[model samples]
Target: MSSIVEIKLSADQTEGTKATVAQWLKRKGEHVTINEPIIELETDKVMMEVIAPVSGVLEDIFVREGEPAEENIILGTILETAMSNPSNEQKNDREIRAEETPKNVSNDLPRKNPAAGQPDPPSTFISPAVRRLRQQHQFDLSQITGTGKNNRITTRDVNAYLSGSMDQSAAQNATYDAAAISPTAAGSEIIPHSQMRKIIADHMQHSVQTAPHVTSIFDLDLSAIIKHRKSNKQAFAQQGAKLTFTAYFMAAAIQAIKHQPKINSQFHEHGLEVFKHVNLGFGTALGDEGLIVPVIQQCQNLNLIQIAQELTRLTDKARNNQLTQKEVQGGTFTLSNHGVSGSLVATPIIINQPQSAILGLGKMEKRVVVEEHNGQDMMVIKPMCYVSLTIDHRALDAYQTNDFLSHFKAVIENWQ
Candidate 1:
């Protein structure tokens, strides 16, 4: 006799918090293999996939798209049965379509299921705005590529496809005219907050409200580090790792933390919780989608090259929306390197909570400075950047904060 099994969101998958139903990977009655992903759950920090517990047919869905789901929530059910092989005709059709599809199309785009002999249903996760746009343009969801989390379609993706299909000059003219129109004259848009955005907003507000923030800024001379990287960057690149300034900064931070262990600590109700190891979290901006911090655990033990490799891997995963939950959690210290986008400095960068302090690195620029050379003052151009440490005043005093920055500056300035 066939048995039905409940498919629930694993408690450990989301750290016991609520998540939004991002998408359903399989439709009802769809055959699924053991451990195959059946649904996606979008939490504040990362997108998590809920996989099937056993090989079976997806029998029913208990949760709808975009709805809040608690930990261990029964999202669906599966009817246990032996997997069936696809017919030759269905398999041939899928292969033909795969060959015909453009190379530029996302591999995650929904296609005909070989076993079912039918195109996968459009995700019920489509936003109202996207649905309206799709209907207005008479475009099928499968025809447009999704660039959002988990390859979910966004309104911008549809608009880009439509713009590409139009004449170049006409598209440019339309974009110009749209920008020229004021929101008051042409109806302002009211976009509902995305789940991720809402969570970020709440978290930021809570952090600001909870902590008495104090910021200390220092300027660092990066001449030695810059020269060192310039000399060895090519050698590092040949080994498949791109040596970046952030890596050097991360290494410097680790060294600084080693000198002052209190910097790599968190605030607790009874007392300060000084961590023995550094779980470094670096901020990665995702444009309008806001930022994510993917942590490099036990960073205290990693060398410069290893730090660079981890930074590159995490940044790539962040941009590609491929980061996991654990990759973003358990951070004891946070760093925000906003300089890459050309911002000179940002003071009082809010601390990522529980962590007592957060570091911010600003733009690196060449500046003329007077320095003693052979007992004579000489003017020379040096690479300089601004760094800030925003600390929770309740947990850290100016002495500890300033000492941390001093150690960090010393490490950067004197790098060999």
Candidate 2:
């Protein structure tokens, strides 16, 4: 006898946030092997694959492509059939991408109920793909009964409508026509925003709208830390550490944050939320795909050597797209070492919202400066860089910002 196995996105999987169905890898009636990836879900931070739980033929697709997938919903189903020697199933393109997926990205959304005490407002999911299908066919989607969450119209509904399988009801539901948007000119190339880029843009825009931003700049001499790195680099390399300037900057940040604890805080209407641990996040550029901030947790407990080791590991993961959901979250503070890209200084680097501040490092270059030697003026060449701290004005001011910068400078300049 054949049995049916339902594919469900568990509550813990979604983490109280919606994941868009980026694509459906298996079609209805297609055979699927156990532990095979059959779907891709696009979350705010990563792309995850939902794996098949049993060996069988896909019987149905409950959530179509380009629809919001919610917790406790059946994504699809498989008709389970008896298998012989299933263990010998060779890995194929259908193999589980467990290393890259099975991830649950963290969010500030409420754990129990995202709505909290207030009732949620009415909203519907009308996807870009569905609208484009409508634009191409001139079919009003209201003619079909929706099977998606909250009775939202989905791509499957449009398909049924097109195939004359749905009611012929007619009415234009004014849904900002995502399909009607045209290009700037006839031949201009248009690349749709990647899921990561789209969410990042929303995050940035939201940060700007929610926070009153202010920036403070300071110039620091890197001679001491540069000397320290050069002296210990070989030893660090022997111990599997990279001895990067980023490691030094992060160590300095920890010292400064310890001296000025208020700098490691998040803003709230009730009060300022100060954290005891320094969980640092740094921007890792992914070239054309945009950058992702992979956080290193509990820096207050780690030494310089340990920090360097972790920096090597996480940075490798970020660049190769191997970072886990947990590896990219729980950051109480952020740093942007934009200097490596040859930027002299970047003012007002956008604050990672909810967090009060973000630190910016400028390019290091040799510059001439005047120094007093035995009551005589002398010119000396030194390596220097401009450091900037951008803070939310509501949670911090020039006084505190300067204090943090001062301590940061002291740590870097006097490193032993």
Candidate 3:
């Protein structure tokens, strides 16, 4: 006997809670091992893969790729007895081989009611115009059957569906009264949030609602780091990589975190949790889908070159939809590099949750500033960047935050 396992959306979609099926890793009838990644879902903030809960042969898929699953409703099913069900196996295999399969099959004619029992009452005939209106409301046509001449659905049917104008005269008064209530009309446009965005939103909101935010800023002279990278760019390229200032900054940030362990502390309901290891999260922008902060664990242990190489690989994976859930989940601290897009500075970046602080880097620009060298004031131009740290005030004070930034600045400015 095949047991139907419904894969429900996890309730922890914190960013915006809107989810869409990005891809199905396992096709119907494919054998999936226990805990194997079976599907990739795109939320507002990031892409997340849902793993199989138990070992099973996937028998059927209720949802197809690129479809809306915004309600976090039941997306699909996994059958435990698929291997034994040879009939289902053959049917799905043929479907997979069919080259004419549509990207979205629901747009086809409404499916016939299942033979199991009474189906929902058919809808009235709707005109093309009315069908368009229903699409705008995210309602499907199959849910409403046609009732006009020759059983054609008309515009009037759609209008009645939307405006509570449908006939209830001695036939279906209860259905009319019940259909009058419109969820969206009550004042919420239900745009689904992507999984990544949902998680980001939840963490950000929790950080804001739970902690008092405080920020500290410092400007660092990046001349030395820039020169070093410029000199070693070719050597890095020899290893099939591009050297970026982020690697240097990340290395420095790790050192600063080691020196000032307080900045890495997390605030909890009971008290505070301090992490001994420096697992850093780098915020990588993924265009319209928003950002994903893939964590590079044990940053304090990796040297600058290693950091650059790892960041390059992780970010490339992030853009090409290749990150695992664990790759994104844990971080002791976070760094957002707005400088990549030429931002000179930013303040009060929302801290990633369970962690106390995040560091923001601005564009490196050449600036002329008065320098006191051996008691003589001399004006000189140097490559400089503005760095800001946003910390949870409940866990860290301005003085501590400032001190951490100051040490980070010193590390960057004096880099050899």
Best candidate per TM-score, number? Answer: 1
lDDT of 1 by residue, 219-247 (tens): 98998898999999998888767899999
Mind giving the per-residue lDDT tens digits that candidate 2 earns over 136-235? 7676554656543334344544654564543333212222234554567987634466556776777788888988888889998999998888899999
User: Worst ten-residue run, lDDT, model 1?
Assistant: 172-181
Off by over 4 Å in 2: 1-19, 28-38, 51-63, 68-183, 186-188, 348-351, 373-378
RMSD of each: 6.9, 14.5, 13.6
TM-score rank order: 1, 2, 3
| Clash number for each model | 0, 0, 29
| TM accuracy, model 3 | 0.66
Can you write out model 3's per-residue Cα lDDT over 271-345, one digit (the tens) per residue? 888889888889888764567778897777888888888898889977755565557666889999999898988
Worst 10 residues of 3 by lDDT: 169-178
Number of the predicted model whose lDDT against the real structure is largest = 1
Looking at model 1, the pairs that clash are none
Error of 3 at 5 (Å): 5.1
Q: What is the C-alpha lDDT of each candidate?
A: 0.78, 0.76, 0.69
To one decimal, what is the Cα RMSD in angstroms of model 3 from the true structure? 13.6
Q: For model 1, how big is the CA root-mean-square deviation? A: 6.9
